[model samples]
Target: MQYLHALETAIIYIEAHLDEDIGLEDVARETGYSYYHMTRLFKSAVGETVGSYINKRRLSNAAKELLYTENRIIDIAIYNGYESSEAFSRAFKDIYRISPLEYRKNKHDFFIGSKKGLNIDMLKHITNSITLEPTIANFKETKIVGIRGEVALKGNGLSCLWEQFHRIYAAIPHTVPNRRDFCVCETNQTTYKKNGDAIYSEMIGTEVDSFEEMPDFVVNKTVKPGKYAVFTHMGSLANLEKTYDYIWGTWSLSTKEELDNREDFELYTEQFYSMDNPDNRIKIYIPVC
Candidate 1:
């Protein structure tokens, strides 16, 4: 938990220096943590080393700059903390799979007035209080229309998934539940990326009983059944992410029951009518053995 506080402080430093040179020592100093401990904490809480995380982020931002600004590639590279154009190009290609010149030519990963940026500001102050209860349950196999994509803990991965859900749902006609949305994290065992990345968050809606054709989206064939460690998260969806860290980072470390090898899910039992209400709760079901 203290490490979590340190992480929050480190993220604030990262956000403050996104456009400047930010090294591990600087982050450690700013966060009041030793460099070794800071690296350990960041890796434990966020999955990647601090250097790798900062490099990837700078490269991601550089990609956006390539698309948004007509600034020279060298300038963009230097602005994002890269030593030289060659170094920046190598790093950019590693993350985005394209060079700055080609990226601009294709107009890829850019938009007009798109503040499509990721902020690590909230990582440090994540409110994480969760109670996990063990129970055995059976869930009826349900079919849903949803968009599926790999998501990272960093960036607007969850927000983008919801955006896709709305876009796909707008094209379909059904009596979908509006307030209680279903977000199922696909099993990490079968589909997780090599870096122990977070599972995909699918924005889903139950298929109408009489819908003649399934929409362009794939039918998510998943069954929610088994023993689980259920945790209820209350408050805004934006803040629900910290709840996940608690489940994975804190609860799992302190619990007797091991996390089950089944798909975990979030049930939005109630909508956030007001952002200030403390009684609103969302249930998180983690399969446990």
Candidate 2:
């Protein structure tokens, strides 16, 4: 578990410093793991070399800037840590199959995939099967007390954090009623890096009336009152990523609603029997304006 936590911390460090000149040694030192051990763990867990991940993320962000911003290609390249425009263009064309200028001219389709391109057909199928109509609910400000950590948005860090939280939840004091667990993703500040990799502060805890008497190890947080687009995720927790992909990639993009800078969270109700259960249902709430 400690190794897993260290790996996640390394991922966050990499994401937070992608625009800077970073390397494996920097990540290893940040996470307090040896260079060889960190490399092996990252490869095993993330299924990609650290250098490859960084390159792909840089290219992905550069593509986004090309489509969204009017910055010159050379400037965008430099901003993304490329030494030269020629090198940046070469890498961009390698992934996008088009020159930066050409992509900007015909910026109709946005590529949001990894080195392995996204399967649009599969995404459509998943979106079609799930009903994502959100219910508008006004929630009062709520307090949560639990252990918190930084997790990489792309890898298994979030899931692993949840597992660790569950293991130690019994030790925490002042938990609330109905066995309702809150998996909160803090997005109000510095949630994502330029490379589209996120360093989210996640907490797995229960609601509390106040934080006055919280234990020393537990962290206290507040969820502000707002209108939320509440969507239900009915399936195993493992497949929750598919639902998220659809929501962020397809639905949110198309919707007219503007998302607010608040913490999005998962409400694990009584129906959530266990992580592996097929029938476990969780409610996802996204703060929206």
Candidate 3:
């Protein structure tokens, strides 16, 4: 979540300058991370780089405005910071899979979705080379008590959700260590909004010993055990997403194993605590064949 904070900060900045000519270097400097680092972090965490995400979002907004408002197509394009309607239309078509003129004539009848955009829950499997190091192992399902929040794939929204969780969990005395804390993210991309954000659950077990006090937490899920491709995230929250891209986009493509459709999760390598340096460490456990 801490690495997410830095990204959230960057997104907020991008939104403010949607109409201006913004550069990656400028944004990276503002966020105190290098361009390469920021790009990798964005890819790993959100599955899209900052520039691509912004372009798609801007074009989406422009398209919406074009249909809803009577503004000239060129005006709408320029307003959203595109230099030429031609340029805007090309980009818009690439994302929406339709031209702007057709879209406008339909009068907001349809919406454009991003092609380069990614699903937030899909785990990326990265390794130095294509090696099946016998990392697969069995895991029993876990039942945890925790609070939940809805989040977008990209936005300042998730950061706020974490803050809210901190507030709610702080009031509950049951969140202390030895009880163990669990953050569960429920993924349903069908309902995932334009922002690519979805609902996530933050849980602190009230009944670590048993399910006597299920409390307000949902007890409906039984996480299945299977072989998993594991990757270690070393140091700092910012680079986590890059690691994901390496695994999912690169390593998975090269390896013989195919990803198994199951709930992926972060395995706390050490005593994982957000209170500790968020960038410190964690393991992404992706179910695979």
Candidate 4:
């Protein structure tokens, strides 16, 4: 899709100019999109606004520099787009729950225990098994009725949310065909924690034609229409993290496409036999520009 291709171009442009002063107009111009159109398309596809993504990426890169280099805090801050050490410290503390100096001092211990340091052999094995290529798909606007919650990206928050949703899914009326279930991940504000955990709104639901006359207890959400990069995840649910690690850590970084700031979801189709079955398969749809 042209939109997806353009988005990828914008991401590449942003990444290359992270140390420079870049803005929406610059990115939109590079991708041949109007600022308004690009903003809408980007927010609908990537889940974070363009400005947010840039800021986060800059801060993330700054954090890495703090850990890996001997540069002073002010220099690191200025280099990453901040004008002053105090301003950078505030932003850094917001996401990482630590000042830049504190982060640098404890970086090794914190990162070593997190998902960022996945075992090389395990990552290779997971990447080897899954096809990293994604199919472009267009979806119409969809209305889903189900349970929603603020979930932590790490630990059992997602699993617990699904378990809760399953307990009441049967009572929700008027589900769509093929028993398709969706696990939509979205962001309300800040994306991640200092420890590398992200907080997002997770909705577990089935597609519905409309939201009218829904029960008071049911939460209704609309999935905006757009082009998506749909990748299939294979193997049991227990090992699903490995698949995601490869997608975000490996494939996304290598591809020309940039992740859209829209809702990314997991679609459970008929092929998803059971959580324990090694043959279980599910489709993961990521909005891309």
Candidate 5:
């Protein structure tokens, strides 16, 4: 969404309210965008939801108090908006994986998630690389067989997995001739590292006509029929992150379409032969409601 004005206003509003309880409606009122629009713009541009960002800010502050000052943990908890020390400890453990008492005793110097303030450079990098509007189309059900493993959101270590997959792909019986191979990612919404890195279960494989004669090491999957927003990722795979930021962070925000909870995948065809070629391109399918 090119609503840069509204997005800018939102960052200002959020920074001002970091010390207190912040809400989407409050930010919307101050920024002049509707609740729905403000929510989308803030998350898309900033890469996080308003509530989660606010929580991180407060927790970061509370952590400082635990390390430097001799303030009581209960007092620090209340200052950060927790009603009780137990509640605060629970939240603290969820992020830091340590109790407040243990954290204070150890006196660990720490930093919460780094996403804060408006990233002007990152936002400006979304050049005319990808299509502004995605092609909305219905996808047919396809059967897949591949090796699966957990991969980090950043620096997706999928090359080795894909290489191993190729060894088995040719031997699989009754393979689809014209269909494109898929790199499927199943994201975990509730789990994240302390530094905010996401871990997703990814599978890289090609379409198969039947489950019979499938290798024991590979698991089979069926992508259900649904509508998706298909965007083209132009250039080498190195810049796919920028294209995705624009798709999930910008285009999806500006559009009135809603996304559904379904498997999203990358389509690999002959264009992918040159993995690092500047002219290479691929289509990414995101399930939408």
Candidate 6:
């Protein structure tokens, strides 16, 4: 709780001075954590660098100003700690997919990329139960057969998918002795964009020795053999996305390893306790070249 309290302090400090020129160094100093410790802990727990969280908060605040006030865009930019309007526009367009003028002009279909500030409750849920660091593994090719469906980017879409899979689980034929299950994220890359703006396809399946006599509704997927960075998540399944945010947001970008672009999956073994149990263990495998 010592470090988590420090993280909470950092978030409060950032929120208190979103309009000020708050640097990572300043936040780290305020938290009384060393610069290295601050960055690493922030990355693991918040799923982003301190710099990133600050900028997003600034932009999120600036967005509200644009909508609610008649302030000049450049003035709003400076108020948000951006040096110039051009730099702010570039940063804003990267996440919101449009210029400030476009965002302000259209009252429809715009979004704030990072809306909420970090809180201690969220940090504890993300950090206390999981080993955020990952181990690299050379995984073997495997096959699975299960139900697949379109799931929304938010909410309990996954629970419904898993329910359908479990109902048909006993009917599957030629299963391997390993009872481990795979919750594979089969995102359709063509329509996919960052920040939950595309159709999400997911599959829940178990390893199978053969695909013979499989039900027509169920399709088979092949997980190609390759190197992967395996991360272990423990605790309630509700906190699972926090772990993914850390992987995709901070770790994947900061690591020296190259992403292999293969299908990544959640591996559920016998060690998995009930979904609500804090002892639940689920392994996440991300392909790396």
Clash number for each model: 2, 0, 16, 14, 1, 0
Candidate 1 vs candidate 5: the TM-score winner is 5
Candidate achieving the largest TM-score: 6
Question: Would you estimate the TM-scores of all the predictions?
Answer: 0.50, 0.58, 0.45, 0.61, 0.59, 0.76
- Go through the candidates in order and give each one's C-alpha lDDT: 0.62, 0.71, 0.57, 0.74, 0.72, 0.79
Angstrom error at residue 250, model 2 = 1.6
The segments of candidate 1 whose C-alpha lies over 4 angstroms from its true place after superposition are: 1-5, 18-21, 110-121, 124-204, 208-235, 238-289
Writing each residue's lDDT as its tens digit, candidate 6 over 220-270 gives: 998789999999988887788767755664465446787776888999998
Q: Arrange candidates by TM-score, highest first: which order?
A: 6, 4, 5, 2, 1, 3
| Models sorted by lDDT, best on top | 6, 4, 5, 2, 1, 3
Native-structure RMSD, model 6 = 4.9
Worst 10 residues of 6 by lDDT: 188-197
True-structure lDDT of candidate 1: 0.62
RMSD vs true structure, all candidates: 10.6, 15.0, 10.6, 12.4, 8.4, 4.9
Q: Which wins on TM-score, candidate 1 or candidate 2?
A: 2
* Residue pairs in clash, model 6: none
lDDT tens digits by residue: candidate 1, 180-241: 45677765432333232435445455444335566655455444556767777766666666
Q: Locate the minimum summed-lDDT window of 10 residues in model 2.
A: 109-118
lDDT of 3 by residue, 85-129 (tens): 999988878666678989877654331252222332222222221
Instruction: List where candidate 3 sits over 4 angstroms from the true fold.
Output: 1-134, 167-180, 189-207, 217-221, 273-279
Per-residue lDDT tens digits for candidate 4, residues 23-122, read 9999999999999999998765554467766776787678777866799999999999999999999987766667888988875323211223234334
Per-residue lDDT of model 5, residues 135-234, tens digit only: 9999999998777877665765666677777787766677787757888877633244544455668888788889897767888888778999998887
Q: Output the number of the lDDT-best candidate.
A: 6
Say which prediction, candidate 2 or candidate 5, comes out ahead on lDDT.
5
For model 1, what is the error of residue 137's alpha carbon versus the real structure, in angstroms, after optimal superposition?
A: 17
Q: What residue pairs are clashing in model 5?
A: 1-250
